[model samples]
Target: MIEIFTDGASSGNPGPGGYGVILKAGKYYKELAEGFRKTTNNRMELLAVIKGLEALKKPGNEVTIYSDSKYVVDAVEKKWVFGWLNKGFAGKKNSDLWLRFLQVYKLHQVKFVWVKGHAGHPENERCDQLAVKAGQDRQRHQIDTVFEQEANKL
Candidate 1:
């Protein structure tokens, strides 16, 4: 099984935000993270999972995602996102991220396990640290265009 741990951070609710993802597959491990100029915490949360799944090399691989976002995990497990889709994501906050998540979610046998934020899970703790660090990183933030565009429209 390919196991992943993910977390997201925002300086403020809609301030600069970022995500961290750690992937463990047997003896191989990788970490991914990036900062966004302007985005919500939930967007970072969902984007972390979407980007992690997109990083997979092959379809049909078993994937287990551990995340700190009930917003992300419950939406899938409780089938709320599908309902949102049927409603055209009406009154939704993160439709773009939801669609992006569904696109990658269907490519694999995926399972989501919700972990409490700031808990003692090693990978989850590390992801939180990484996400915090990412939010503070002052490097180029051009990768936030999609998020910025949406923020502008709001």
Candidate 2:
């Protein structure tokens, strides 16, 4: 089984954002993080999970993801994302990421466990630190083109 711990942070609602992810399986471990020039926290939250899953070298592994974002955990645990997909994702945000998520998601057996943020969970706290640090590093931040393009239309 693989365990993933994830966190996301943004300075503003749509400001610089970043996601942190830690993947652990047996005696192996890995950490991932990246910053976006402009993006929402929810995007980062979902992206963390996506990035984690994408890191798996082989499919069909059982994955348990720990996250603080209700927006992500609830949507999957409650089957909201399936409904959204069936309805063509109308009126839904982050459809791009969601679609990408579902693709990688189908390749694995996935579960989500929600944890309270800043509650001293070791892995969660470390991910938060990585996310916050990445978000603060303006120089290395990459453009979230999909998000920026969609935001421009609003």
User: How high is each candidate's TM-score?
Assistant: 0.95, 0.99
lDDT of 1 by residue, 1-154 (tens): 9998999999998888889999999999999988877777998899889989999999998999999899999999999999999999999988888998888899999999999988698999998888878888868553667767777887
Residue 119 Cα positional deviation in candidate 1, in Å, after optimal superposition? 1.5
The true-versus-predicted C-alpha distance at residue 124 of model 2, in Å, is 0.4
lDDT (C-alpha) at residue 8 in model 2: 94
Report each candidate's C-alpha RMSD, comma-separated, in the order given: 1.2, 0.6
Scored against the true structure, residue 137 in model 2 reaches a CA lDDT of: 91
Model 2 agreement with the true structure over 37-110: per-residue lDDT tens digits: 99999999999999999999998999999999999999999999999999999999999999999999999999
Candidate 1: pairs in clash: none
